[model samples]
Target: MKTAIKICGISTLEALDAAIEARADFIGLVFFPPSPRHVDGHAASALAMRAADRIGRVGLFVDADDALIAEGIKAGRLEALQLHGEETPARVAQVKERFQLPVWKAVSVATSEDVTRAESYRDAADLILFDAKTPKDAALPGGMGLSFDWSLLDGWKGRPGWGLAGGLRVDNVAEAIVRTAAPLVDTSSGVESAPGVKDAGLISQFCRVARAA
Candidate 1:
């Protein structure tokens, strides 16, 4: 199958358009307040409207409450919910039931054990996003241009609903795909000119590379 691409942390219409032009399979709108890429309901609503059905909209939340998730879903018209926090398997199942949308649980990987932990969410999560684990003092959980050892997933045979994230750039995305055999590759800071500032040219290049890989 062709590798799918997700351009995440899109907070502006320009970035959203760039992802659409790049033919990204999914575009993430962050709801986390602490992140530089954070987007409010009004902003997400406009972006979602502009997106229409051109691309899948995924909402990124960090241990958010139902009220916030509901607002984001309505505003962003999200097709999927990416939980990038310490949410457990039960919590993952709960969120899926309450929202009736595909729920993605992001597992921060640093070692083989971290990758193994994702199995617990197989029954609950619609997708398991394997992201690089951040520092204890880091302000954000992801979109920090950090990556874990790709070899850790060399022969992964667990749940098939999984994707790779973190530290992916246009220069290395092809290699990442070849190395991990990731069905879907997600990026946020990789195509950005600065924190939360996406560059249209870079977005196009990254998608092209992933497709060709």
Candidate 2:
């Protein structure tokens, strides 16, 4: 099967266009205020309109409230919700129930134990995103360009569905795909010229490499 690609932290129309041109499966719009890639409701609406049935839009959120999630869903016309914070299984289910959208719970992987922990969300989330863990004091949960050991996922058979993220670039995404056999791959800082700045050339190249793998 072909590995799906998601270009995340897309805040500008240029970045959104790049993802669409690259034929990426999804583009992430961050709603967390602390992240450099965070976009307001109006900005997200414009970007969503520009995307308009061409590609899927996933909204990234921290431990946000229902009101904020509602605003993001309305603004971005999100197809899915990616939870990237310390949310419990119940909360995940609650969000999924409230939004009535496919919910993806991002599990921070630092060890095999962390990988096993993803099972808690198997029933609650529509997908489990395995991402590298960040420091407890760090301002951002992901998009730091930090990767965990891919070997930890060797022969991993956890359900409902899953994907790989963190530190994936054009040069290394092929290796990541081979190692994990992930059905989907996501990247943010790896395809950026600077923090929160998505590079169009890099986006295209990353998609090409990931598909070729």
Candidate 3:
């Protein structure tokens, strides 16, 4: 199977085009205001409309309220909602039912214990996204562009429907796949010219390399 690639924190038409042109499986939009990549609901919705149907559109949010989720739905043709915050399983169910959309819960993985967290949402979420654990005082929950130990995934067999996220770049994504054997990888900062600024060339390269891998 081909490895899935997600170009996240997308805020511009150019970046969205790059993701679409590269045939990325998922194109993520940051809805949290604190994020440099944050996009207004209208703007996000506009960008989503321009993407090719082959690329999935994802809305990224922390432990946000229903209003935020409501606005997100209005903002785009979202295929999935990525809960990147401390949301409870109940909340996941609520969001899924209310929006009638698939849900992907992002679990922070640092130790073996963190991996077990996915089981909690097994019934509630459509998929799981393993992201790096943020420090206590971290500004935003994700998009820090940091990587955790890939070896931690050496024997992972917990979920077939999860995505590997955190600090992935074109150069290392192939190795990450070889090590973790992850069928899906998500990246934001790693493919950017700067924070929240995606480079079209890198987007193309990442998709090509991951597809070939």
Off by over 4 Å in 3: 52-54
Backbone clashes for every candidate come to 0, 0, 1
What does the lDDT come to for candidate 1? Answer: 0.95
Each prediction's Cα lDDT score?
Answer: 0.95, 0.95, 0.86
Q: Write model 2 residue lDDT over 89-123, tens digit each, in one string.
A: 99999999998999999999999999899988989
TM-score of each: 0.99, 0.99, 0.95
lDDT comparing candidate 2 with the true structure:
0.95
Q: Give candidate 3's root-mean-square deviation (CA, Å).
A: 1.4
Q: Over the stretch 146-185, how does candidate 3's per-residue lDDT look in tens digits?
A: 8888777665675638789988889999998887878789
Better structure of 1 and 3 per TM-score = 1
